[model samples]
Target chain A: MTVDHEPVSTADGGEPRFSTWTGKARGWALRRLPPDKLLPEGQPSYVSSWIYVFGMGAVAALVYIIGSGIVLALNGPTWFHVSSLGRFINSTHLWSVELFFMFMVIHLWGKFWMAAWRGGRVLTWITGMLAFVVSIVTAFTGYLLQTNFDSQWIAFQAKDALNAVGIGAWFNVADLGQILMWHITLLPLAVAVVVALHVVLVRMHGVVPPLEAAASDAQLSSATPNPATESEHRK
Target chain B: MLGIQQTDAGMPDPGIYFQWGDFLIQFGNLVVIATMVVLFILALVIPFPGRRSRK
Candidate 1:
């Protein structure tokens, strides 16, 4: 019943614990993302613009969607199909998804107009797009799991198209077990991973500056071209 | 029975108090399709009337 109070020492005058992958990860993270840069209290002044806020809104909506989804999942599938309370929770999840999609589309369009890939933000941009694609796939599988007339019609009508393309063999929406696993587990997990990476990249590289600000700043910097300033703002 | 069973969803419900309450819900499919079509067209031709949008 006694717990050991002493730390384990390595045999060869060095600790294996400090020299492991965990230590390397800690060092790498600290070097790449210090706490102040990772989670800043004050953003750059240019982020004050209205267009920059939609990304935050999308993240917020995603949080709500996940929270509601967990609640609904805990209640099981039949409750949401039949009970009033479950129906309300289901509706909340649905509306949250609608908001998530709306925010994502607006954010994507705004970033596109901003030419947000300027400098080294290409991976940030791509991950966001990939998250959207994953979310759409998740949503489609969700529709298949609806257990309603809508789901029925979608499977009935779309099965031919899918089979013709050979996708139906692998991703059979008509198969409840397959689609449900995808809806509840695989797709959502993929989306979460991609979204996490997207946010980390955003935090790693600070929010992109406005075109005018970047242009003026570029002009002020030394004549040597900074990769960040290589953008030609469409005038 | 397993392949194409129909559910009671989308069937008309008795709405003595709210006759037209389901109108929007009933027609939402068409609205969604139309909206997608419109949005796609807009995306293709948007930032329009110039070489590139100044914004």
Candidate 2:
């Protein structure tokens, strides 16, 4: 296959001749995450601890969950009860979701202790926290969409709780269409977007150094206005 | 059976529960929480392959 080898002509100011949207987007992306850092060949030695793996583990489990979910969606919700293959995929999806939550919670705990938000990474921490909240809502909707006795009972109980809080008036747990759409579409999309942002921020900032390192640095540079002590200095 | 149907659905198994005043949690959930705590500790202590721990 032949591909265009010619580059876009440049203006006198060195901008692309046409200033196409793709060119601008590419420039913006490169500015945000340069090639070397975005796909680094190595990380800081402190990142060798096993705790660092949980974030990637959560992401891997999410991949399996989405893959199995696609299969279940294609076969329709009830097909799992009737067919062996569908049942297998359903089981895969359920187990993957369980792993996803387990890994994500572990990751959250690791980050909390490490204060992973250090060094201008507060947005990373916020995005991760948002992903966890969105994921909980997604999982709740999934439970409601199970189409079983448990789901029916859960919906009724949840309805009472939501009504007590006055949320049931606007968000009906008993409404299958609403819950199904939330489970299959809206909540998942929200989770995906939040998780993507979290990963991008992590990549952009690089993994945070261990707490001891940061503490020693703060002590060494007590007079300096580094991120670790900037807030303390503020007060 | 259209979807995942419980074998006996009178009331789903309310697994073992523990309560301390107002704080209550199911046994299974407690186990999950405990396991995560243990895993976090282990992850902190466990060394990654081919890497020496920084002094």
Estimated TM-score per prediction?
Answer: 0.70, 0.79
Runs of candidate 2 exceeding 4 Å displacement = A1-24, A164-166, A214-235, B1-10, B53-55
For all the models shown, what interface RMSD does each have?
8.1, 3.2
Q: Let me know the DockQ for model 2.
A: 0.41
Which 10 consecutive positions of candidate 1 chain A have the poorest summed lDDT? Answer: A218-227
Model 1, range A105-155, lDDT digits (tens) per residue? 767877887788876789999999999999998888887788876787787
Best by lDDT: 2
Best by TM-score: 2
Best by DockQ: 2
**Docking quality band of candidate 2, CAPRI definitions:** acceptable
lDDT of 1: 0.71
Itemize residue pairs with steric clashes in candidate 1: none
Q: What is the DockQ of each candidate?
A: 0.05, 0.41
